[model samples]
Target: MAKTACDHDVLIVGAGISGIGMAAHLEMMCPGRDYAILEARENLGGTWDLFRYPGIRSDSDMHTLGFVFEPWRHEKSIADGPSILEYLNRIVDERGIRQKISLGTKVVSANWHSDRACWELVVDKGGSRQTITANWLYLGTGYYDYDDPYDAGFDFSAFQGQVVHPQFWPDDLDYTGKNVVVVGSGATAVTLVPSMADKAASVTMLQRTPTWMFSRPAKDALANFLRRILPEETAYKITRWKNVFMQDKSFKTARNKPEKVKQFLHKKIQKALGDHYDPASFTPPYDPWDQRLCLVPDNDLFEAMKRGKAQVVTAHIDSFDATGVKLKDGRHLPADIIVTATGLRLAVAGKITVSQDGTPVDFAQRFYYKGCMFSNLPNLAVVFGYLNASWTLRADINSEYVCKVLNHMDAVGANVAMPYLADDHGLEEEDLFDFSSGYIQRGKHLMPKSATTLPWRLNQDYRVDKKALAEAPIDDGIMRFDHVDQRTQQQLEAAE
Candidate 1:
């Protein structure tokens, strides 16, 4: 048997927000630890590079979305995609992390060798197979599938003018002065309808159900004001904390006082749309936060509607005709172009086949530990951000926690650390995500379960997780640590 060389101290998959942030955290926290990032795409920006549809931008404000080590100085907190990509590039360039990233490399599978105390990865790098090993595996391979999006199951005949999915948007496709129909009620659909309205003859948002929508200023005046008086770091920190606090408070209020939050959000929408607002087209069936609320900076979507350049239609998509979508209510929307702003297909751990000592590690069967690591999983951490807030908010903390875990393991001379879930943990199983988004519902079975108690429970609250991941003792009894026995280590060394 050929020996596989151990490549680095840590191997991070997917060079997106999470991967980049994790690398930076390790550099800062564990100065001498060696790590390399493997990115499937050729570009550095993961989601930002993958998505190129019109008006692609962050739904969450950049203050919280931005990395903790880096301050977002851009005036528009709700920034466009290119700006985000540039920001990510800047981080990589400045930190000298770009040299460590291996592009066009896709991880196929990871096999953990207990005796070796390391993970051997099979990878496809530009069509050639290769192997690399690492003591610790970190997955930043976010939750979305780049190859396929959620198909809404609409049957369309060959009369198509132009059919597109936002995930695979075409560069040369022209919609100028042509009727456009955007399907879905999520953030993508909301962002597209208004953006396409600027040039398209008419833009219509078609949805089977409504999503809660809110509008805020594109620029953060308070953040700018603070920058004028306070130091840059101080101002950014204050604004970031403020946004985090507000988000946490609002989410709690929505969960506890659904009716109140519903009314408050609805009134904002009604006021924006004015007399043109049809409550049925904007009001969601479930309470606020049941699904993520669609945010439009400066009431762009509502403004487009008011200006008669765009409109919202609430009805079921019966099927797609050659020209456009046909409604179940027998309404026909004529369009020269159709944009399926449909949701993403969720793929956990970049769809990599993971196993421990010949036993397959099924994520669905395991429980989430601190929403970052999995129960009974050793020497691995998965960075899955908040479903409710800015993804980076969770990503930042996950990086910090991983660093702490590594430091603790090193101090104790432990080669392996795993979150041990006892049989008698006595925690009730709950759905991985409480959100009512269709995409999540379709793939909920593939997601790992969360417990109802502390440590095991996802919590999903930033404030709570901040302490749990950051301040909590790393040597907590739940996480077991051990080193490979001397005889086994000798055997592995001899084999090598």
Candidate 2:
């Protein structure tokens, strides 16, 4: 077997949690594998580094969100953006992954060459374009669009006040002593309403439709207690598993008994808001887990409402008047600053133009293989995290699985490994993501196709994925492996 000439064995896009996690797995599982992380931004940390909005924090708990290799020592389980960024920076530095990262280098396009069994990547760095080749391409780029956020098509030109989006929050903008109105009722809106309420004269969350809101303490009492009695690694592992189990069970329960979960959530909200609680404002039209539940840490949003510092207005925006937003119900909300915390615009393969032997690869037309690789896509794995649980949980398992595939390829003297999807394959195509979140619904067309069974769809359950991804054989009958020299021979055999 002969190895192809390439710049690196593996080229990972995005220096965020997914990319960093993949590199770490490669180091531990497949030592001496040459790899480089290409980050488009000038800095790393991905979403954490990108979002600097008020009250920017993780909706998910840190015990499960943190990498399995590293233990989260933060007292706050739902950590702030800066704290999460610090955690990521520490991992890169400690693991010597920082040196391998190429900041400001963005992968614009990637083409797979079957003849050489390698990927040619076109990257842009400071307006200069360059090409790099690698035996394997791993996309750790997150699901959302970095350049463009979801546009709700709100006409803010008529409004006299300043309008901003949370995706590209201005660092110098100050809303102190000014009335602020945040649009939409997603996680971002919930987070911003309470955070801005502290300094703003009045903060109002304007929503078209209500979203399921749940409140919990920012700090994990059991996790803190476990840390006091146990070693850091052991305590972290126990807490992580406990959170994973709870998350899975909660999601399942919500799907199974929506009414029960809805009542439980409403009770918590009522307890926090007291007299301020409005069933119409807190209750969503759909079931609990239809979309992600908005996490209100320490009852911050409810506290703000109770204190008269913040309010939740459920109405459709007819238009933005000079004074403020004009509601369809004939109400005008005065606002000095408007923050559009609408939602994210989902993207696939980091919006990179992917091609196979000069033929454009449309992910939506292809099937997702094992939640990592795509059908007929060789030597490539894209990390798409679990929507129901922590993003890192899926990332961790996907990284390990990719490493296993790489090692298996090496053992078999194979240069290319592609999941073959035949025309007559009986796999039924299903929605890639089950969530009815606005972003998911809007971006469904751009996502890869999913089947009804395992290894053909992206499993949202981390517990099931953990076992399957770990124990599943790398050389599954569906995946075709061949050496560089055998490519032509295999193609000829397939043609016949």
Candidate 3:
């Protein structure tokens, strides 16, 4: 077999927020380091480019959603998908990151070549396979498999009508005047169902469990005020902090007193929809934030139902029929198009194959070092977004910390960077996340601690992570390094 070529200081996987943010920092702070962003799709924006369903928007505002250096200046707090995509593309163009990205290149697997003291990455771009090596691996794959959405689309196929997974929405599929049935109760489901209701003949939303739905005007008025006067970055700061506090306060209420959060949300619902809204039907049986809270656009969904445009059907879908869904309650709801707004497919370490030398690390037995780094893995870090806040907030801080560690490495003339190893499960006491979503459930054991109440714990609070990451030492207890020769044994063994 031909030997794989090994070169470069850093190799980043996936050109999403984390990848882009980390790349920006690495090039700026770690001068002379060679890095490349490899992407599977022939586009820059990962999630935005992948999902094109109607009414798609960021679940959180763009202020915190944007990179720290490049703040989003849009008037609206919560930006739609197109605008978000445009913003990312603008950055890629302005920074000339487009060329640094190997478009259409998908990372199949990355193996630690102990002999080289770096990682050997295999990628498939188009039909050609390429091998590249780097001293450090930054994974920003965003913990999702876009293809899996439709892989679970078989139940949806039972319907005689059109079936589409929001992630893989067919450009040719049309929903005009056709009755639609949307499944799932998360952000994707709510956003797609009501927006389609505007044009479809009718819409029926099926849910396995209920989610706390909060109503907010898509465009926040105060943000509009900030946009007119302050600089875009300043406006972004204002809006970002505003959302940080708002979401924090809102989520705190739910975690503290479920009844109070429900009451507050119900009051808003009553005021927004008035007679058209019925709390009895809309109110979720479980507490708010049990999973992820559902965000609605100015009660636009409720208005659709009030205007005789749609209806919400709460039931467990046992299967699908030729023209409708068969509920566990023994009732059939008809439709012309079926969209499974299901949850995501969970992945750890952005699906990078972590190994000791060439031996695959068993994720089932492994523990998270922090939310960002993995145990037993050296010279590697994964950037994961906040399930609670706009992803960019966490990503910005994560990249900053990563750069800080890299800087420390350069100062010490170190060859490897790794998580601060810890003994025991080392997991925090209270649950960081209790989302009942399947993805969360599947990988809950391997995830890092939430430590929402502690400083060491990743709070997803930008203020907190910013300070914590700022203090991490390259040789902190979680990490250790040796001179080049010391790493050669592992590298040579893997090569053999």
The top-ranked prediction according to TM-score is: 2
Which tens-of-lDDT digit does each residue in 1-496 have in candidate 1?
0122356779999899999999999989989888899999999889999989999999999999999889999999999999999999999999889999999999999988888778989999989999998989999999978888898776667447788999898999899999998988899999999988999999999988999888899999999999999999999999999999999998889999999988888899889989898999988889889999899899999999999999999998777778887788999999898888878888888899999997888999888888788998888988788988999998999899988888888888887889998877778987668888888898888888798876877778888889777667988998998886646577877899
The local distance difference test score of each candidate is 0.89, 0.92, 0.74
Off by over 4 Å in 3: 1-6, 150-158, 328-330, 420-432, 445-460, 472-474, 486-496
Sort by lDDT, top down from the best: 2, 1, 3
Model 1 vs. true fold: TM = 0.96
Candidate achieving higher lDDT, 2 or 3? 2
Supply the TM-score for candidate 2. 0.97
**Structural similarity to truth (TM-score) of each candidate:** 0.96, 0.97, 0.90
lDDT of 2: 0.92
For 116-162, candidate 2 gives per-residue lDDT tens digits of 78899999999999999999999999999999999988888889999
Q: For model 3, how does the per-residue alpha-carbon lDDT over 343-431 read when each residue is reduced to its tens digit?
A: 67767666656676879866555444445665567777777777776788777776776677666777777766655435764555556
So what's the TM-score on candidate 3?
0.90
Those runs of model 2 whose alpha carbons end farther than 4 Å from true positions after fitting are 486-496
Error of 1 at 205 (Å): 0.3
Please name the candidate that would achieve the greatest lDDT relative to the true structure.
2
Q: Report how far off residue 359 is in candidate 1 (Å).
A: 1.7
Better of 1 and 3 by lDDT: 1
